[model samples]
Target: MAWVTWRQHRPQLVAAAGLLFALAAAALGTRIPIEAAFHRESLAACLPPAARTGCDIIVPHFEAEFGGLVTSVRVLTVLPVLAGLFVGAPLLARELELGTYRFAWTQGVTRRRWLLSKTALLAAATVIAGAAASAIVMWWRAPYDILEGRISPSSFDIEGLVVPAYALFALVLGVLAGLVFRRTVAAMTATLLAFGATRFLVTEFVRPHFLAPLHRVVLATDSGRGPGDWVLSDTLVDGGGRQITAAREDLAVTHAQLAGIDPHTYIVTLGWKRLIAYQPAGRFWDFQLLEAGLFVGLAALIVLVTVWLVRRTAT
Candidate 1:
């Protein structure tokens, strides 16, 4: 079963390996200079809960130089979908579509066992490949991540257990779609649509609420940043928690200047404060584990459904 599976899927396996190699090469080549420059600049001094005055002058320049890489990394968000379309969607669909599953199933193995073996093999391969890709990306992005914080979608999605889990989810989604659609192209399309929608909804809506976000209030003129927090929103509010506008803030500052009082002091007297909502940096790993578990659980459920459907078809 394993040999037959490998023979049938060699193209996809080879392609996945090639893609991982290319990503590693690109990441390593780019990361060497980035790491060197980061050390050379001694920008660790600018990390939060510490002096950041130098960051005002230095960080922008670093971003300007390497910002393209940052944008490029965002493109990897689509990688799992590609895996589903090419690898998983066609895994069973092609055989069933070609009417070759009949012959394939008669080769001395029960259909259910055959299906489970092939799916499990492919899933294990995908997890390994996805982990390799995640490791490469995270290692390459370490310098940028340290400066920018990893809680953002781009950083969080591509690192730790989450990336492999995402790949697993997409793969199972593709397999399920393939079984239901029974045509490779149709399955691919369904996989793309379903995976895209699930990912979009989770990323944009569900992930943020995994834990209640934290809040901090600062004086209107004072700097407010804790180390590596995923800042959700900042609002200017009075003691009553009514949102205030920038225009109102500027006017208040002007009035304070004319009255010979410090702007911050004046704002405090008026009960104006900046309210920041954030997910603390300490929660990075916790969120990673939670999101990964969510996807993995979904994948397991899909696997169970696919198995049930396959067994029914054979019966």
Candidate 2:
């Protein structure tokens, strides 16, 4: 049965393997020192000759951020999508379409057993593929991450969280789509649409809440009277990268003596900002766990649905 399953799904497996191999090769090739030096080479066109300091951090006059964005898109966005589509879309739909389920059923394999074996096999393969791709991306992007200051935990919280989980979700979603649609083409299309929609919703609407809800802080300094008043604003961890909003602490005013008269200036409060930053007391871990559980639960739910559908399905 296992051999039969492998033979049946060999096309998808081969395609997935080939795609991953190409991605791996491209990633490795791009990691060469020369490749990094040449990334976005067109940016040099905008720089003045004198301004071209050979210092590492020199801005290329064009968008330096574009390279990192492209890398992120390739690693975290494109590959996982292809994995989901190729791995999940045809798990069972092909069987139904080809009328091969009759043969398997007549051969004394229970529908549940058949479904379980295939799901287990495919799910394992999907996870392995995702893991390998992620590891490769992480390794290849390490230098770029350091150069771009993306190693900061805060940045990781946003980009890293969304991509992998979305990949897994997309895989499970493909399975469910295959079971529900029972046609190869329809399953692939539906899986892609549903996957894209859900990913859009989660990343935009739900992700910001994981870290203290996003808010803006208005900051300004005032010089006046006896001393410059440093208002008491929100206290954040120094160098811990937490952003907060609060009133400034009282500050004393100080000035240098002019030729004749001492210059005195005072600052009056104009207004507060349109938004404020505040950390949820301790919801950080809870949010992470919640998101993780949500993805796993969603995957489980889809698997269960697939199982039910398979039992009832003739194939």
TM-score of each: 0.88, 0.65
Question: Which segments of model 1 are wrong by more than 4 Å?
Answer: 48-53, 220-227, 244-270
TM-score of 2: 0.65
Mind giving the per-residue lDDT tens digits that candidate 2 earns over 5-120? Answer: 69877987898788779878977776785245545443233233333455335433222644655445443465566656877777767766787767776667787887778777
lDDT (10s digit) by residue, model 1, range 1-315: 899789988999999999999999999888988988888888888876657577777877887888987888888888777778998899789888999988988788988898889889989998999899989988988999888878878788888888889999999899989889999999999999999899889987888899999999988776787656888888889989889887988999999999999988898899888999888877889999999999999999999999989888751
| Candidate 2 ranges beyond 4 A from true positions | 34-76, 147-165, 214-292
Cα error, residue 61 of model 2, in Å, equals: 6.9
RMSD of each: 3.5, 10.6
Q: How close to the true structure is residue 289 of candidate 1, measured as C-alpha lDDT?
A: 93
Model 2: lDDT to the true structure: 0.56
lDDT accuracy of residue 11 in candidate 2: 88
User: Backbone clashes in each candidate structure, one number apiece?
Assistant: 0, 19
Candidate with the greatest TM-score versus the true structure: 1
